[model samples]
Target: MSIKKEILKTIGDLLMEKLKNLPDGLPDLMWFDKQMGQFVPPETDDTAGGTPEAGISLPLPAVLMEYEPFAWQTTGGNTQKGSGNLKFTIYCEHLADSFPGSPVRDLALQHFDFVAAVHQVLQGLQIENVMSPLTRVLDEEDLAPDGVVFSVISYNTTIFDHSTSRTRNHVMVTNPGLEVKYKEESSRPVPAVEIPAFLT
Candidate 1:
């Protein structure tokens, strides 16, 4: 296999292995979300003359690019802060069901603390030169409910020049989707309601 393919395979293997170690239900749910209507095959039809059949139909534009976390040290000069930065991605259909109300999306963020280990192992779990995975998601601008496609990205910080602060930002530049979630959201306070003093 090509070098890139091999590396990607290795990462995938690690992700699967790490996912296996997750608390049972969590991993299953992730898998379920990933598997939902995600593939589209080429169009074909019954043919006798070896000629074209009917009109062409567009396939669903959906995909899932998941990565297992990994880290490698200063292997050498050519490597230069190599592997200091890591990245993970997820591509899928961003259906109306896959947003805030979707448990899978919510749970994925929740499990990052545990699932993150999959990548940390690359650096022996030291976490000295690591950054949170960059996570970027893409979908339709107007965002239709049924067939909108989406993607997710998570990036690890890089330790360039041996300094920790100059890290690569996660969610590498891109226009985000209509929906977003923050880890600190749960900690945010709800707006207070005011009642007429006379009603009291």
Candidate 2:
């Protein structure tokens, strides 16, 4: 598999392993967070205010690309230069037990653990390896306006940023939580992913 797919696959598998005991399987091979809860509105519409329905289940968050161009320089008479793209993707998810949402500190811990594990795996590889869990952002303040705070960035520049000199690249591993502003996958029923009843 290409580095992109390989990295994603590793993360998806590891997440499932962490919550291996949870039922309701993932739809295909997706990175899932089963322990977390979904966000909900405080007020409801009814004769009076009614209780909100159950929280929405979520899919494995995707790390969208954040691209940057590498600068190059030449010592020729014309002083030529070149540019290459440095691509990044950050994936994250957050939970809301109450109005504001789940505590940020708790999720930060998960982020750290995930990062450490991923880093270890990446460093141990022989061939050019892919990082797992992506890169995590620990600060609640770093979140996007919508609410996503924590994130993991898994990226490869080899394809976009080719080099003639010796390639020097480092792996950055992570898995930080992020708040969700978008809607859930409620309309399309979550597929039946059955686990052994005995485990449940």
lDDT: which candidate is best?
1
* Per-residue alpha-carbon lDDT of candidate 1 for residues 83-189, written as tens digits (9 for 90 to 100): 43333423223333435767676543443433344334433322323233332232222222334233334444433233322242223666766578666647678
- Overall local distance difference test of candidate 1: 0.36
Show model 1 residue runs off by greater than 4 Å.
Answer: 29-63, 66-144, 147-151, 154-200
**Residue 96 error, candidate 2, Å:** 4.6
